[model samples]
Target: MDAKVRNNTAHSRYELTVDDATAVAVYEIRDGAIAFTHTEVPRSLSGQGVGSALARGALDDARAAGKKVVPLCSFIAAYIERHPEYKDLT
Candidate 1:
């Protein structure tokens, strides 16, 4: 599986593409903070780590840009819990 992640800023989402499936982690950027709003991983793409890829990519982007993270989405918050390096962003 050739999966890749991209930040589509115009759409406010970090998209993870695997084969024909695409998962998205939607977010909002405001006042130097990025609030992760939602995560959508299709059933066809479930259990393939697409959601984790999206979460990692989005959080990495936030860190690279020096932006704070408000993980409104439970998935992202949980991801942060698993990856403590990103905790300070919250």
Candidate 2:
């Protein structure tokens, strides 16, 4: 899982490709905030931290862009809860 996440702005998502499988975190920008709406990781990639990596990358992007975060996706919300360093993003 050395793959780096990329922001696909045209598609409104962050993507991480590993072993030909791609995981995504879908989001929408509203009122200067990035609202994460969904997260998906291939079943074959589950339990391998793909989702966590995606979430961290997305949140880091948001921070870099000076945008707040609205974690509408349950997975993202849970990730933030676990990683308090990103709590201020919400």
List CA RMSD, all candidates.
1.1, 0.6
Backbone clash pairs for candidate 1 read none
Count of backbone clashes, every candidate in sequence: 0, 0
Model 1 C-alpha lDDT versus the unseen true structure: 0.89
Please provide, for model 2 over 1-90, each residue's C-alpha lDDT reduced to its tens digit, 9 standing for 90 to 100.
679999999999999999989999999988989999999999989999999999999999899989999999999999999999999999
How many pairs of residues in model 1 come into backbone collision? 0
Model 1: runs farther than 4 Å from truth?
Answer: none
Q: Which candidate is the best by TM-score?
A: 2
lDDT (Cα, tens digit) per residue for candidate 1, span 1-90:
456689998999999888777899999987879999999999999997888878988888888989999999999999999999889998
Clashing pairs in 2: none
* Ten-residue region with minimum lDDT total, candidate 2: 1-10
